[model samples]
Target: MAGIKQVRNRKLLPDLRKEGHLSKEIVLSTTEKHGVPAGSRLFSHHTLASVRKLSFYHPFSIPEDSLDIILAATYDHSYEHFADKEDLYLQPETRGCETWRRLRNTVGKPPKPKIPLGHPMKRGGITERKSPFSVKLMNSGVHSSQTNPGYSRQPAGGAIFFY
Candidate 1:
């Protein structure tokens, strides 16, 4: 955690430390695939204070729990949230008979291979990391399960996930 700097003056999630575990603020990439529990509560907000404090993107409270379990919301759901919603997935425009897109399909499309680098912005430096394509997102109906994180039994599933 050498280069990590905790954000100050921000309200943490309620009951952040009922147990001994700590909470972290996560930022996922647009091309990444993360899971949220089927019915887990998902929310968004931009407070005057928070907006002022954060420079890049307002904090996205990706739950370490409520959204920990597995779900069936796995459509072509990009890690598409705010902020990069525009830069990563810009819309097309038409002028008279000409229709042009700000991006080319190959800019970030198939046939073009994606390299497996660790989460670059994560606090610690990157080590050779394994792909989480097999993590078992356990079924649950509550926040942080009595079970470990959705990643305990890591290499359990397959690449083709079904709803």
Candidate 2:
């Protein structure tokens, strides 16, 4: 295995700023394979004014994050779900194919797990009055949001970001 190249915000911040993203850290380094994973590279395009991150969506990794990252972790994970673009990067490059598209068609995105509260409706609280209602009364159950374990227990508030 190659040695890790520690990241410095002094350098990373500039790149982020060029891409319209900003960070205030004076230093940044990633020891984990995921953070600065191998095989990643700097990609440039004519349209980009400055550096913009362009990384391949490798096999989807479940990063331990206190909150969702790039709105991805928020995906309903009650069941295994792959991103829409995953198959595109496959060795065969099977983009725009039905095989990948219909993989989960039969089993749609199911609702997240939840505990049905008691009520004639299975929903907590009384409907109209003390009269109970059954699960029939409630079309949905109480649902809660979830986040994976934190990759690191860093204080979110202290971080500085430029708009």
Candidate 3:
């Protein structure tokens, strides 16, 4: 049946006793997943003038019944608040294009094959340059245009034609 103030005061006494003497100001704040409880109160008799005379209170001094209520309310509040925030961040609009772009950039793409200027391969000379595609096509019975005119559908064997 102790009042909130009396309970907090009681909690503070033990901590002060343990320390033997107050030496500094100690701030206490709790962040639970659900949120802070309304019934939970912080009471400190020490003033700023008593900066060297302040001590922290023990959390265990609060009655079990009050602690249970505080924890339940705090857990509920934290869960709701954080869940909403998570939902907001996870929404399609918030994490669609930009996130995808970031991931794509991080993974990177294969580099493009570099074609040198003045190289015979650039001028469609199939005799000197034989690429893997051409070899495969030749192995597959598709004749190169250089070797057979009628069978050549497009530029054969990875040869580039620059007019």
Candidate 4:
């Protein structure tokens, strides 16, 4: 039950430049906990360079026996929503583990069948072709090598133009 801090038009630091993976916005002068019940704001900078240097991962250290956060949402519905809803911060076993790796030594191994198109059925499927038209190039070969009367390519290895 702390006061919220209002931040506006603040510049975010780049990601790669930071040491950790996730770099959330700094909660300046706010008594709010990170990922509080109320939704938090994510910011972006004009330059891609600034974003590249920012961190994308949260730094919360997971206890050796605990799971990691899969989903984080802020909600106001208390009572049932708070009791029945699953906590996004809880990481269940096999959450981040590869499914195939976990099933490696399991029993009742079903024979892997060759999917009609590919191993993953979703990606392999025949689709109707729309265009029956024979492809034709509008431009045949090169136009007259006529150099523009006004402009021409600089002599080979010409002076380098610097910004």
Instruction: For each candidate in turn, give its C-alpha RMSD to the true structure in angstroms.
Output: 29.9, 29.8, 23.6, 25.4
Provide backbone clash counts, one per model.
0, 6, 6, 10
TM-score (all chains, Cα) for each model: 0.11, 0.13, 0.13, 0.17
For model 1, residues 1-163, the per-residue Cα lDDT tens digits are 2333223322322222211232435332222123644233233322343333444433333325423312212223466455433343222222112122211111112243344684435567776776765454566446544444443333466343333
Error of 3 at 42 (Å): 44
lDDT of each: 0.33, 0.32, 0.36, 0.37
On TM-score, who's better, 3 or 4? 4
How many pairs of residues collide in model 3?
Answer: 6
Model 2 stretches with alpha carbons more than 4 Å out: 1-90, 96-122, 130-163
Q: How many steric clashes does model 1 contain?
A: 0
Error of 2 at 75 (Å): 32
The positional error of residue 9 in candidate 1, measured at the CA in angstroms, is 4.5
lDDT of 4 by residue, 58-92 (tens): 43333353232333222234533544345544333
**Candidate 3 lDDT, tens digit per residue, 1-163?**
1221112222322323322344444554432323455433333223333432334422223326744434433234445654553343242313433211111112223454566764536444455665667453434654434434334334466554443
Error of 3 at 19 (Å): 49
Model 1: ten consecutive residues of lowest lDDT: 100-109
- Model number with the top TM-score: 4
Off by over 4 Å in 3: 1-85, 91-96, 99-107, 110-122, 126-163
lDDT order, best first, reads 4, 3, 1, 2
* Reference-based lDDT, residue 144, model 1: 42
Give lDDT for model 4: 0.37
